[model samples]
Target: MIRTDDTRYALRPGVTCLTVPGGAVLLNPPHNEKLAGLTPAQSQALKTLNQGPATASALAAESDSVTTLLDRLAGAGWLEVTVRDGDRDLYTLRPFSTPPARPSTGDGPRTVLSKFTVIHRDPDGLVLEHPTSWCDFRVHDPRLLALAAGADPTELGLPESLSARIAADLRWGGFTADPAAEDLDFTTRSWSAPDLWFHRRSTLGSRTVTWDNFGPTAWAKDEFPQRPAHRPAYPGAPIALTAPDLGALRATDPALTAVLEDRRSCRSFDDARPITLTQLAELLYRSARTRSVETSPDGAELPSRPYPSGGGVHELELYPVVRTVEGLAAGMYHYDSFEHALRLVAPADSIAVQRLLRTTTATLANGAEPQLLLLISARAGRVMWSYKSVAYANILKHVGVLMQTLYLTATAMRLGVVAQGFSDTAAFTAATGADELEECNVGSMILGTPGDRPRTTD
Candidate 1:
């Protein structure tokens, strides 16, 4: 059995004890309101926590009055408890996001590690963390780490005392799974670990867990300088695109309802009557062109486009990989939305480019190949520069918005368009000579002349 006397307690990380005119106020901003009205003795006791963890017996010996306050704070999760053996700390239960509910008492079912639990190195040597967990366990002992890593006490041949201690720590951290809960719910059973983790972190579920650092925090500005308004212009002779007259098109364009109803994923294309360069230019202009560039209050350039993006961080860039078009050469060209032009990145017959097109053709599952394959990439740093955890999720959302915009626009122009659900980053990187981390493809779509009888796969 684990000894309670060996447990040492301290204030949770990020919690501060303030000296007020009365007793003292415990301030954990964004998590709790000021916990005011404490006696001088209680405040003094809480202050001693800053020095480090102390046992209840030790604290009680110093001042008997401090015991009640310590127990209250520990129960409320304002205090973190560490199990110690001499100088070595076995493990520490640190409250991170929410006020932790006390672990269940008494022996329960046979335990297995939760599938969602992850052990990663942070400032602390190795931390056992879960996205939906109210607290994280800072593991110091290898024995405990092994237990968290899915070692059974019997298999590890750990001493009974040490095994019991590790098991208690595991219970406190909720590292074990609840098979009953998992088996009972269909939705719970269906969720993969990564999807559940992503869903939990990207959206705010609880005020106690999630901080108010949402939207345009500019979290990375200090570490990395803000990226320029536009990516550096691609090398090669730029292809000047035709900017269609908005006034003329406004009077002649299809109605919104007609375009919406006509929108479908068209897999078949007419190679005989391929889309002309002028038509391609109009499509790009109408769907993805930068209307105007303006500076944010924080001095970052925000480009307004036909589609909406999170924090106006228009990170998405277009590269049209062409196979056949009446007026344009067969090549992969970067769409310069700001300048309304294209810069050739790769030849049409390049092995890498052809491989990417071939993959899409196979994915399309039709006899036809894409006449014009548009690869949509994201300058991830643009959004990451401003936002924190939600950067990638926001990028995916932007991709979806742009896809819909492309769909409607292509439908109006009576062109065949099909949004591909998957893309090959390696093929794209090889074709464009771009770093995957710096700028990688997030989405892809195929566009061409609508066949006499277009095959729809909506």
Candidate 2:
């Protein structure tokens, strides 16, 4: 199980290591794994391994602890034993964790591809999709699907190239993925963190779709998909059917109902007529300002805002990138909901701040650049600390609710507001100087004085 002189290796895709001034580090980026820091010798060994796999002796020439370091990386789901040049076998690093080599059988029932993977239809007819990793590959011939659906490839007369590729993927654990793959009895196969990670990512993000779809925005393909007997929960835990039993859904004011129907999305804003500081404060107070603060027996303080959040955690924070807000200099400010004030963070001209603004302006490509932008972020630990199972999905739900609140509040105040489809997450993190793992930009919105009124009546 250890590397020997006869061994050789090839670095798997996305496995990289570098010696930094602070320290040496390796990353398998597909899973966003920021692994433990490496030592000087360990970095050298990785550089050597990148060429191909080498025996322990070859690696130790760089440092005495090279083998130990390699072993540690392997423990972190980075290594797999493979043959190179048909002469020697050594380990390789991969972004994902590898399971045990595979189960050997005593010559009994049969073998089939793991149910965790699927053969499904796409624009290209049929494809092999790894449920755990969202790694998909196209199939040239439609007949290959039968083999992919547990039929023996040999009996199906599948194309030779297709058969070979399928076999390779199977042997590589691409088909029978670890962690979430089920046994013949349909019980989960692995319990390790990596295994569970693959399980959660695939199942929660892409395997199923919701009517509202506050989860991941991708899905696996299935031909003639049947509705499952059970579906993923759209809402969590106790039902909160807590809305008031007001007669029928009706807006009493004819003008307010007209406002609801006439609301328009303003893609362009007027830079000449900047929004007043008082207007900005009123908007925040109505949409996101804290009305009350309460501390749980566990000592976690919860705050109230116009938008409803799961468990009143209020994990979302707003970073306003102001290009032209009256009485406020062009800069980045963090909205302190409790203080009902903007905490000055950085000037608008700084490189990181400029990058975020420019990137967002390009992303919004709606004719004109925004003067007032809001970067909505979520505190991962605060939200996930309480709801481990449904943390991210509900965070997205909270994002939707808060976004609607901003939209409505902006509409009432006669300011333009529109949420971007996406934003540069890395840029936002740097702009805000936040720990990438602890806080992340979930969504973004732009607002300012409108260029011209579209309409306010249905």
Candidate 3:
């Protein structure tokens, strides 16, 4: 059966099937992986499948060719049995568009979201990308995300037009029907894994850094990369900043050189003696406190921090989970750069807060607790708004700067410090009440009294 122009056919999302001379080629663009070429007979079967769904009985009645062709392609998820009303079923190919979230027949079947489906929301809009779709569906419909999070699309009460658009997006973008059937154990990690999943031309998915997707072919897009306008300073943190003085601003060769040499990774910490509040204040004032807040060309207020950033966007924000800071109770506090003070995020000793501290300790010190742990979160909006390809990476580099800054500062003050590369990222977001996609823990570090320190001569 051939589908008309208005009729939606199941074209495999992200995988492109080309009808070539001797055989048909099936290419999975998202992974840059290709299936074995199909012979002319097999290609005809795929072509028929792409055109429209057919039943084994119907195909068998037409000719044994259809059944034989389908039999070859049926293994390994290439085809699925879709049941209709009265329990009638059709043998369908891998991908078929139109209401990709569910079946076309009313009262036929309600579709569910795939566990692998990642929902990302930006100022631009919501983008839903499943593993199958090597690209993103830029959803303009506001109700879509809310709908996606809730029940099946059929029960959402979405307007006819919006519903139709969503169905089209699901069909075209490669979201699966009945996402619950698949064993998504792998996606549990890959779904929120730190990596760029969406790009033009090149394949998407995987936990590899975004840069890995970059290839000569990826650069051949129609439009060149335009540096986006810098995002405004992180909002809602205290506007007032504190500027504590570090006595004697000395930056000479040997003094600076010694401090630099002193910078070392300290795994052991003096848990008995907690860091004084004065030390925390001084550290913030010198290392991360905002020096100047100025308006950018886009009129967005940008902050200048102690460390350098790619676009001066200062996308990094510090959240210190205090285990034992003098005069400060145990809790998670957002370091208000402008105010130069700690803004209470979660009450002291909250379960979420303790879990984060404990988790960080596990990640950084083999379950040993520290006096202070700084969770470095990136305001991705600020970076992605100003830059393209290198946005997430710049945040990572900024984390490096923050790490070095903390390392040297800790050394100068005779405090122990170390940076940890891993964390329960999803848990971090939950504890901090941060949006998983927008604000994330890019890196983490610990600060406390030096457990092992010795005098050194240069």
Best-fitting candidate, scored by lDDT: 1
Q: Please write out the lDDT profile of model 1 over residues 255-325, one tens digit for every residue.
A: 99988887888877788999999999999999999999999776778899999988787999999998898
Q: Is candidate 1 or candidate 2 better by lDDT?
A: 1
Worst lDDT run of 10 residues, candidate 2, spans: 226-235
lDDT of each residue in 1-458, candidate 2, tens digit only: 33555333445445675545435555653343443456667766777776766666677743546767765655554553342223422112232444444344234344466655655565535655554643344454455567555666555564454344345545444554332334433445544334555456534353333323323221221222222211112122221112222243233323566556646677667789988777787777777877787776745567777888877777888888888888777887777676666766777887777777776666344545678888888876566655534667777888999888887767777788778878778877777677877779898988888876452221
Off by over 4 Å in 1: 1-6, 19-24, 30-43, 50-58, 61-68, 97-109, 153-159, 178-185, 207-214, 365-367, 452-457
Which pairs clash in model 2?
Answer: 8-53, 9-52, 9-53
User: Sort by lDDT, best first: what order?
Assistant: 1, 2, 3
Give TM-scores for every candidate, taking all chains together and pairing residue i with residue i: 0.87, 0.49, 0.50
Clashes of each: 0, 3, 7
> What is the clash count of model 2?
3
Among these predictions, the greatest TM-score belongs to 1
lDDT of 3 by residue, 1-458 (tens): 22212222233434456665556655553333233554555556566666665544534323555445554443222443332222322112233222233234344344555555677776645666665553455554454566567554554475454355455446444564554434445544444323424332134223222454332222323343322223234344532333554555454223778888777777777767878878888787778887787776645556788889875778788888888887787877788777677776776667777777777655444568778888888877666664545566667778988889887877787777878877667767767777877788888888888765442232
How does candidate 3 score on lDDT?
Answer: 0.59
